[model samples]
Target: MDFSLSDEQRAIQDMAAKFAEREIAPHVAAYDREERFPLEIYAKMGPLGLTGGVIPEKFGGTGMDHVTYALVIMELARHCPALAGAASWASGVAGVSVLRFGSEELKQKYLVPLAQGKVPAAIALTEPHTGSDVASMRTRVIRTDEGYILRGNKIWVSMIKSCGWMIAFGTLDPALGRKGVCAFVVEPQWPGVTTVPFKNKVGFRPMETGEVAFDDVHVPASHLIGQEGEGFRVAMCSVENGRLGVAARSCGMLRGCLEEALDYIPSRQTFGEPIGNRQLIQSKITDMVVWHETARLLTLKLASLKDQGHRARQEASMAKMYASDVLMRGAEHAMQIHGAYACSDDFAVGRFWRDAKFMQVIEGTNEIHRWLIAEFALGYRR
Candidate 1:
């Protein structure tokens, strides 16, 4: 029942927390207002050795471990979930995939710069027609003389505007179902690649969601990750790791919302007395603490399983579901304590409310995750 973090994990968390307060807190609201990606920050993070924390040193990364990475993500997200979303998409999701599957040349070309924060990458699996049902994607890639010709549309691509490379998935042979899908690295400078910007998202505005269209975009066979027809496995692997990142982010959001509510309760006055002294406010704050702790515990459990090299598919789903649900609950309670002021931009609670609502929708919606968990609990699907 010991519940202490290792020295490395604690150091990573503390560094992330301090960096977020110093670098992220000041511009978060402005970034949300402008709906612009924080493009210049990575240049600064490169010299600070923050970008490549978990990547192996061979690939020009510090090569720590999963739990440390998850902890760092949580600490950063507590300050600016938007910035965290963008960076995690690159350094967390897409970055992890490259480390797992890329060829040595691919590693030298893409992974090194990515880990060093010199280049940004994106995972391009979700399309306009498919999200959680990723196996049904319609994008097609055909074998050519030297490589593959890519043609499809990927929508809701987080950080597309900022990414220099994309790890994209498409069906090479449709008859094999999910087995036919293959993934390849496509540079943004490649011919026939175009991007359409998204604006005014309900939350995570500075992350820069967009649609990427591949019109006869050609990539060399050397860019293929592992082998033909292996994209589905690669995608699933990245997502299993990604579930940990999402759970961590959601848990941090809950903690941030609770932190705000606790601080405001005592300092804010109602009925000529501090709100913290009132029993009603105290009850609301208590519920927030409960939700925050529940989410944090789930995050830690998932991280431990991942660190042990277990598959973690079911554990990841459970952690993502519970943590995201708790994030929503904490946001709701935080807003309730503020009354009317919660709806205003002047207070940070409003942003947390919107962000938490989106968390339930993103990273495989809670509905889909429940089905996944149920299949395992039932001893296999009926």
Candidate 2:
């Protein structure tokens, strides 16, 4: 099988790499320290088609393939995962969901603006009590003659403050379980919607995270995505895209750790010799290299499968689980190699370490993925 990137993909990758180095790298530390979302950077990305690579050209995006989109995310993430994450959330999860399930009128009204980066998009699925158990969400929705009335609370809603619209999932009836769930597009400026931003996050500090409360918010009938009782399917479909983005970002973090360690080993000396000469150090570097390549390959494979129009749920879980695990391990090794300097803000490895740990938790935790992978392997799931 061919494993090489096409010429167009390579060019896109190079362009994204240059853009990240020029536009994102310099501001990483400041953004992290200030806990500020870089709206200006996203403004720049809008014109470059970086924020909407997965969206169709008719929707004001580049209409790029999934593999190319993955490459762009990887390059952007190499310098700043948070920036990459915001872009991914917009294009991959929120945008894709709208495009896949929304009515034509909804697409024209919301998806176009989102694709153009005229507005940001947010998804509210995880509640205060439910993290990975999306079907158990406590948010309640009632059908009305005009539309739907939603009332509930959601935590860890990313980009809530800046989002023009949010995709929120709620249950029509508590007794019906997953079958009762429904998805709606809610305008954040509505009368009953309120948000409180979280601060001092250990990782992804630059991206906004918050809790949202909807108090009988009135949503028009046109805002409902897909048919009623299809919210579970909508959430699961969007999660595959989220997992792919997470895997790509994890691979990029792994590459950053490898590069950081390699750069340090040659300059650091101990007992009158460079640490690069030590077999243990060499072994760590070797493992880092292997992990980075392996994670990247798995991520690309998943992308390719998606591009081929396959469901590929198992592949998404595997790539997301393995790549995130690799990123965590690679960050730890890089920090160990850097020693005391890693704890200091002077080195980027510390940030990578902090961010790496979060990757294992988002887009479905590694623990859940482990169970899923096993179930898939044993023919318990298909």
Query: Which parts of model 2 have CA positions greater than 4 angstroms off?
Result: none
CA lDDT, every prediction?
Answer: 0.80, 0.88
Query: Taking the tens digit of each residue's C-alpha lDDT, what string does model 1 give over 37-94?
Result: 7767656665555677567788877666767777777887787776566446534667
Q: After superposition, how far is residue 227 of candidate 1 from its true place, in Å?
A: 1.4
Residue pairs in candidate 2 whose N, alpha carbon or C atoms collide under 3 angstroms:
none
Top candidate by lDDT:
2
lDDT of 2 by residue, 1-382 (tens): 4568899889988988999999999889888889888888878887888877778898777888889989999999888998888668656668887888999988888888887777888889889998988888889999899999999999998888788999999999878889989998889999999998899999878768889999999999889998899988888877777899999999988898888898888889999999999999888899999999999999999999988988898999999999999999999999999999999997899999999999999899999999999999999999
C-alpha TM-score for every candidate? 0.95, 0.98
**Which residue ranges in model 1 land beyond 4 Å of their true spot?**
none
Clashes of each: 0, 0
